[model samples]
Target: SGCDTQTVVNNNGSTEYGLFQINNKIWCRDNHIPHSRDICGISCDKFLDDDLTDDIMCVKKILDNV
Candidate 1:
């Protein structure tokens, strides 16, 4: 499904944020979650804006690992 930067969804106990719907439990850090890996190395809120630079960078980082 397509989404925008403002998109946020709760799936089971995990929350997905921003256009990529990045999961707080894995990719990005959310204050509410205590043990997130934060692979993106940035606040989850950074993805929730018009600028896609950080979002794209994070995606690239994610792609590199796989």
Candidate 2:
């Protein structure tokens, strides 16, 4: 369950962020990218905080969709 909240650039040009490792191409939007689904209705930066309330909520939304 322990994971880093820092942003990580992947080899394929996508970015993963926060404890959940949410991807920019699907769950979150990278400002540099033109398009993203952003199903959680939140910026990727929100998940990078130590407080995980927003991240947990976003995770629930994603789980609901799946």
Candidate 3:
């Protein structure tokens, strides 16, 4: 997927970003999401950049939590 790729998963404004499709509702912060969580402690927009390092780290964090 493109670095800036994003998809709205539901009508409630829940969105996923980048190659991993990290969700703003739980993994990252997004202003558009009224009740978003930053469990990965990252801005959702960071996942939209070309750098995949942070994205991978966030994924690892998610997996650890799981």
lDDT by residue (1-66, candidate 1, tens digit) is 276667466756777777877778778887778799998888888888888899889888888978
User: Model 2: per-residue lDDT, tens digit, 1-66?
Assistant: 267788888898888889988878778776955598888777889878898998888888889988
lDDT of 1 at 36: 93
What stretches of model 1 exceed 4 Å from their correct place?
A: none
Evaluation by lDDT, superior candidate among 1 and 2: 2
Highest-scoring model, TM-score:
2
| By TM-score: ranked, best first | 2, 1, 3
Clashing pairs in 2: none
lDDT of each: 0.80, 0.82, 0.83
Ranking by lDDT: 3, 2, 1
Every candidate's CA RMSD: 1.6, 1.6, 2.3
Q: Name the weakest run of 10 consecutive residues (lDDT summed) in model 2.
A: 25-34
Evaluated with lDDT, which candidate comes out highest? 3
For each candidate in turn, the TM-score is 0.82, 0.83, 0.80
- TM-score (C-alpha) between model 3 and the true structure: 0.80
lDDT (tens digit, per residue) of candidate 3 on 28-62: 98787767778998888888777899999999999
